[model samples]
Target: VNQNEHTPTGTIREFVALSVRSINFVMNAFAWIIALALLALALYLLYRWGTANYDYFEQRRVPYVLPFSAYGRMLTGRLHPVDAAGEGYRVFPEERFSGFFVFRQPGYLIHDPELIKQITIKDFDHFVDHSFNISPELDPFLGRSLFFES
Candidate 1:
């Protein structure tokens, strides 16, 4: 009896080894497919997040300007913040207030003094608490600002 001889036990062992290799190959392929699917899902979710509030002012029938072009200019230093603000005001000169976006966050450009007074004084309490959270430990200046006192 030689070790190289093809005995029944040796044949069975070889078959088992080949089956394991095939199973491993299939499992690796399945894992890669699942990983690619998850990556695609994450990208789609990011896109949804970026566009979530794009139609916010439009749906409410508010006078608004799309900020993407201006935002891009500002990011590249081609447009100054003051110039961007002026542009927003010029776009809706007759409106008392106009809407705009900073990415997906909505904001207002108030062109009327009375409305500004109402929001700053008469309705001060309502606007006191901002919708964003800041950690004092990370950003003490902003976290301790009057607007974010609470």
Candidate 2:
């Protein structure tokens, strides 16, 4: 028989099937690579969460008197007035002496209770104004209270 005469009728169908199989193989490989990358990212985040240290306040506990200035409280175990103002009600919602850090400064974490109490309740005269200055003309809705104003 001649080669042309002996050729199978299913030759075109076999070629189409082979092409589809190759395309599916490439797609499955690509999908597996993407899934592996996502898994790696998730593992890295879990490792960071497990190993990171967050003991900024629990290490030290002492009673100290702070100076009478907006920024001086940071020096005497009390958080900076500016940092405290930014936190609003988040810090010390029901109590005094919340932990805070000075920006770009080392060994600037504060955790004294007495000084914080004075600044918050007893001697409000010295620390009456906020360290942050916001013009009321820009934001008319700003509260007049020193603690809540922007």
Candidate 3:
């Protein structure tokens, strides 16, 4: 039953199997390459999104504090709200306000209490909503809370 037979059909079958495996390997390698490219593109887009508001103040012709990546100036602002506000305030102390980035969001920091009072009180109608509204679907409690509601 164990005859040493060098059949041409057996050789062709082995060659076909090897060819299929080679093709599969090449296809897998190409798929991996495409996946890596997409991952890199996603990461780059995320980085841009995180830093997109970095130049808002510059374009608006308002003085602004230098920002850090991803978290913007918010990282420092969160830790030291008064000091951070003062830093932006001093940048253009003579002016009424200066810009600061709360993460990717841009907002003006008023240096004078009178200006703040005018904006918050006298002109309250125009700017009724103080807190930024988040998605209720994403965070049910905080997003729909009275504190966030206008």
Error of 3 at 67 (Å): 3.6
Residues 23-132, candidate 2, lDDT per residue (tens digit)? Answer: 99999999999999999999999866643433434456522122123245556757756555445235445534444434322132234567667667877766545555
lDDT of 1 by residue, 44-105 (tens): 99989998998988999888877777788899999897777666688888889988887788
- Using lDDT, rank the candidates from best to worst: 1, 3, 2
What is candidate 2's CA lDDT for residue 23? Answer: 97
Candidate 2 global TM-score: 0.33
For all candidates in order, the CA lDDT equals: 0.85, 0.54, 0.76
Give the C-alpha lDDT of model 2.
Answer: 0.54
In model 2, the clashing pairs are none
Candidate 3 matches the true fold with a TM-score of: 0.61
Residue pairs with colliding backbones in model 3 are: none
Per-residue lDDT for 100-129 in model 3, tens only? 776677878788889888877778678756
For residue 33, model 3's alpha carbon misses the true position, in angstroms, by 1.2
Q: TM-score of every model?
A: 0.58, 0.33, 0.61
Instruction: Indicate which candidate wins on lDDT.
Output: 1
Residue 111 of model 2 has an lDDT of: 40
